[model samples]
Target: MNTDYTAQEIQDLVSEVLETADENGVLPIVQLGHPVLRQRATAYNGQLPTQMLEELLEAMRQTMYDAPGVGLAAPQVGIPLQIAVLEDLYPIPESSALEREREPLEYFEIFNPSFVATSDRQAEFFEGCLSFDGFQGVVTRPADITASFEDREGKEQSRSFSGWQARIVQHETDHLFGTVYVDKVETRSLINESELWHHDDLDVATARRVLNF
Candidate 1:
C-alpha cells in the first residue's frame, strides 16, 4: 500500500471515503496508520461546495454519537479539514462522582479551531480516542482553556472550557495539528480501557501504577 500521501491527496481520498459512506450509512473512520491522520489539516476556507460541508458536519456528528465518543475530528473520518464536533451532554451516573464537575456541553461544531490556555492549573486524566480504539492513556492538559473558531453558520465563536470539556477541546484541536494524545503519554502509562479503574482519590503518581499494565 502507498504510504506517501500529499495533503491534497489526503483530502481527496477523504471525499472519496465519504462518498462511499453514503451507501453504507456511516463514515468509515481512518485508523492509526493512515497517512491522512498524520498530515496537518487545511484551514476551511469560506466555501461550501453544494452544501457538502454542512452534510459532512452532520454526518460527523452522527458518527461521533454512534462511536459513543465525546468528540470527533475531520481527520479521524479521513477529511483533512479544520472541522470537529463534540458534546458531553449525556447523563452521568451519580456513582461516577469524579466527573460531576464536568459541565455538560451542548453539541458544538468548530471549524478552524485554535486553543489557548487560560490558567496555569493543569490536570491529567486517562483519555481514549476513536482512532485508537480500546486503549487509554494518561494525558496532562491545561485544566482551563479558551478556543476560538467559526461555527457551522460561519460566525466566529470563542468559548472557555474547563475540566473534561477542556480536555476534549484540546484533544480534538491537537488532531488538526496531526498530534495524538498518545504522543504526550508515558509509554508505561498506556493501558487497555478494560483494565483501567477510577482513581479519583489517588494522586497522579499512584494512579500511574494503579493500572494493571
Candidate 2:
C-alpha cells in the first residue's frame, strides 16, 4: 500500500472502501501481516472533504464497536492515515474497573494525534489489538498522558488522561507511528485469548510470575 496519498487519492480510496463495506458498515480490518500495519501512517491534512471524512470516520467507528475494542486507527483498516476513534464504557465488573483505574469515556474521533507522558508512573496490563485477534500480551505504558489532536470539526484540542484511558490513547497513537503492543510487550507474557481468563484476576506481578515473563 502507498504510504502517502493526495487529497483526491485519499477521497477515492475512502469512497471505495466505504462503498464496499459489509451490511453492518464495518470496513474489513487488515491483519497483523499486512504491510500497512507496519508502515508509519501519513498525517491527516484535509486530504478528504468534510462530508467524506465524516462518513469514513463513522464507518471506522462502527468497525471499532463491532470489533468490541476501545480504539481503532486508520492503518488497521488499510487507510494509512493519522486518524483514529476511541471510546471505553468500562464494560467490565466494577471491581475490575477499579483495579485497572478505568473510567467511562464517550466516543470521539481524533486526527493527527500525539501525546506526552505526564508522570513517571507506569502500569502494566494485557493489551490486545483488533489487527491481532485472539491474542494478548502484557505491555507497560505511561499511567498518565496529555494528548493533542484535532477533533472531528478540525478544532485543535489537548487534554490529559490517566489510568486506562491513557493506555488507550497511547495504544492508538502508536498505530499512527507503526508501533504495535507486541513490539513493546513482555514476549513471554503473550498468551491466547482463550487462556486470558486464567490471569484476569491476577495482579501484574503475580501474572508475570505465573507466566514466567
Q: Which candidate should be chosen as best, given TM-score against the real structure?
A: 2
lDDT of each residue in 127-189, candidate 2, tens digit only: 999999999888999999999999877799999999999999999999999999999998998
lDDT score, residue 186, model 1?
Answer: 62
lDDT for each residue of candidate 1 in 1-213, tens digit (9 for 90 to 100): 344456556556656866866553578777888876787877776545636666787788888988889999998987777889999878876544364247778998899999899999988767889998888777889999999999877789999998888999999999998898889976677877665654443334666567533
Q: What is the C-alpha lDDT of each candidate?
A: 0.79, 0.89
Give the runs in model 2 whose Cα sits over 4 Å from its true position. 198-200
Model 2 pairs whose backbones collide: none
* Model 2 TM-score, all chains together: 0.95
lDDT of 2: 0.89
Q: For each candidate, what TM-score against the reference?
A: 0.85, 0.95
